[model samples]
Target: MVLNLGGFKFEWKQTSEIAIETDFGINSQERIANFEALLSAKLGSQSINLNGQTLPFAQDGQEALKPLYALAELRQSLPLVTGLGKYLGRFAIEKISENRSVFAPNGAFFTQTFSLTLRRDYDADIA
Candidate 1:
């Protein structure tokens, strides 16, 4: 599967999971026997977990995470690309955590695993 966050293309690892959510409201009013209102569409945000993956090449640890760090700092909407399709809108970077597994000769992290969370933008289109 291919994933594109804004313009950054990520290399997928062997293991990954995609979660999709939909919300609805059930009405218990005495007038109606049973009624359900669609609170939201399948347009709900998707949470993806890219567990245990190496960071892209860079001069050092900081450099490798520079782009990702920038995205985290922006905290703005971004275009999200999924294998099934593509979504254009705001995507907020929820989190970015790293785990160092290997070190370079200069004592910099050569191999590191990073986790990221992105939230989709909500608008009237879903309603």
Candidate 2:
């Protein structure tokens, strides 16, 4: 897995790419005023796609559906610890979007795809 959100894993097969974005939140005035100063900066938001597919070699489709289920059950009110390679931080799940896919007779899904939008939680007490 290339990334780990909370306790859910994002396998390389399921992920095409991982993108992390940072917004300095520096306005035009701030930039001009602090041109010679070492201004403070804030972390911005990030998003990722949690994609999975059931492989024929697998015994069941549960492995493909586990991350989807976990994301659906997550509480947006709380912040979750996330790690991507060596980067680690506390972030809140700002939004979640899922794409439709086929399912089996036993309710097992053939594929699971989700887009998660997260924002850094700056609160110091959010452990």
Candidate 3:
């Protein structure tokens, strides 16, 4: 798979899902638990860079949510495709260091990792 990480600098990984160009956006499950999207993109390139390591979209909340850019998981947002099927959005979240939980706040405690998930309204797919 080819991914323009930031600039034209792309990343090629051993892809497991086939890129799907549907009537609206792209879709693929080779990367997410259930692959599907609205545009035409290599679905296998969805993930997050944590401590310089790429991690799955969902990590079972075992470790802290790091403040880094990650690939958007399709299944986490497919059901909410609205208005001409606009399913492409740069979904990301950084660790809320300032908002440290006093006691299990935002599902966190201490300097716990928290995800800046697709805004609450768009939480149907990427959460």
Index of the highest-lDDT prediction:
1
Q: Which ten residues in a row have the lowest lDDT in candidate 2?
A: 48-57
Candidate 2, residues 1-127: lDDT per residue as tens digits? 6666666666666555545676666533335545654544544444433434334235434555556456647754333443445655665666666564677787766555656666665562355
Query: Among these predicted structures, which one has the highest TM-score?
Result: 1
- Model 2 scores a TM of 0.57
Candidate 3 segments exceeding 4 Å error: 8-10, 24-127
Q: What is the lDDT of residue 70 in candidate 1?
A: 84
Ranking of candidates on TM-score, top first: 1, 2, 3
lDDT of 1 by residue, 10-92 (tens): 65552244444333333333445666543433433444444445543542334565676787787776767765676645567
Number of the candidate with higher lDDT, 1 or 3: 1
Candidate 1: segments with Cα more than 4 A from true spot? 13-46, 55-62, 83-85, 124-127
Error of 3 at 54 (Å): 4.1
* lDDT at 47, model 3: 32
Candidate 3, poorest ten consecutive residues by summed lDDT: 5-14
Collision count for each candidate, in order: 3, 0, 12
What is each predicted model's overall lDDT from 0 to 1? 0.58, 0.54, 0.30
Considering only N, C-alpha and C atoms within 3 Å, which residue pairs clash in candidate 2?
none
- Judge candidate 1 against the unseen true structure and give its global Cα lDDT, from 0 to 1: 0.58
